[model samples]
Target: MVQVDVFWSYALGASFASAASRQLKIKSNPFQNDYFTYTLLYLSCIFAPSGIYLLWQFPHWETMQVATCHGDLPAWLVTIFSITNITQGILGFWVSYQCIKAGRYYLAHLQWFLAYFCMFFVLVHGWDGLGWQRFLYDPTVLNNQLWEPGQHMGLTFLWSNVAFTLYVMGIFVIPFMIIPMSKWIIEGAQNSPEVRSTDIPESIQEIGITFLKLVLGCSLGGAIITSIVIYIIRLITGNLLISFIFGMSICLVSGYYFFFQEGKICYDLFKKLFLAEPATSQKEKS
Candidate 1:
């Protein structure tokens, strides 16, 4: 708990610094604004709720667990919190995606955000082990399993709760982050003014279409790859933890490939969407 608190404090400090830097840069050159501040702010906002919940729940985990198990909390409130918790990391990625799509930052920043989420989850699940489903299915079962002299919710459980929350948060974060980032990279690489050094620009509608195509193509490819990897891992090992680790490894590799390999598969699909017509008209072409 202390560590987490300290972490938030450090983030707050960094946010302040980023804001100051952005302000200075804006004053010097408005058009040269760096989005580092906004990105930090987005990250802080996305995680604030989870951090608050962590602090509140760490000391009251048993009570909350019992409440969740018995449906003691109001159904609507429970649903809302569940959704928010589940989408915390995703919220961060979404903010980054909006920035990237709007050309607020470099492609690398988007990749960094996606990579951060992945590493965050890797740390989380690696520490907590993979009994999360069991715990969710039956809190009482977990209680029984942990029932022993001097064995109760303590520092260890507190840490585990943190990991569990992060894992849930990461479920949507990684996949969504990649979609916008991939599209932006492909578009920027080919016809963006930054790359082409031209005055004319691509139409918004065309950009949107290309983005959608990349998103759909990447989604299909990722799903297929993930499914095959998980199936093979399951066949090789009966242990959930091993399967999970391998699955995560595969995902990380796939993410790297998609983000940096120029997304050729999706690029091809984008071209097909318009019958091989240019997705974005280059300045020279225009």
Candidate 2:
């Protein structure tokens, strides 16, 4: 299962990155874009179920008011937040496109960042809204009134959110960025050996390889650990929300340790077994 998780993560990251890169380059090089286009179609097919599930579970206004922020958000405020989120996302893309047309890369990035912030807030608000279900399962608790938001529950919700955001960044966004950045680096190196030797030294390349390895390990190990923890918590507590929170905690800790510590050690050991003595010597300082 662990190996399966690792393999799936690597495949997904690589495929998604490659597909996105291909799409971006399609305007410049339309030839042979068919393969990636087909890949994207298949990828979308695979992701459709998950997307459907999310939409199915998405909170309505009644639940959103009680589940998210302070547990008493007015319907008008929720409507405003939802509208702003959607509007900003569309505007942000348009602004980014205009900025790129004007060759203002930094400004484009800022616009995109603003869009991301709006989208993230909306997502977190939805997750917080799910907290309402924590009380729904209890027959003793009245369904008429909103449950009081306790400090412990609020903090746990916040922490789970932080973990989930980081997890997505580590496993998804990073790979997307890396695919393009690595292509740029490789192209630069090919065009100018001097740039390769000076701007991106062997040490830097090794560091990148190590980081990639850590990410792979963390993606695999973290998923396995999180699943096990969630399963155990659910069995013991018989509460979906509590189990999810506990799972997020375990996922965060295991991911951190694997990415920063155990993953590096495992990568180093693997390299030692396969790499030549000269290669090992170059890595020794690291």
Best by TM-score: 1
Model 1 segments beyond 4 Å from truth? 1-201, 262-286
lDDT (Cα, tens digit) per residue for candidate 1, span 78-172: 45453443244334334434443343333313332233343333222323332122123322325434232223443444456445776786564
Candidate 2 clash figure, as a count? 2
lDDT for every model? Answer: 0.39, 0.37
Window of ten residues with lowest summed lDDT in model 1: 15-24
Q: TM-score for model 1?
A: 0.35
My TM-score estimates for the predictions, one after another, are 0.35, 0.32
> Which residue pairs clash within candidate 1?
none
Give the Å error, residue 286, model 2. 39
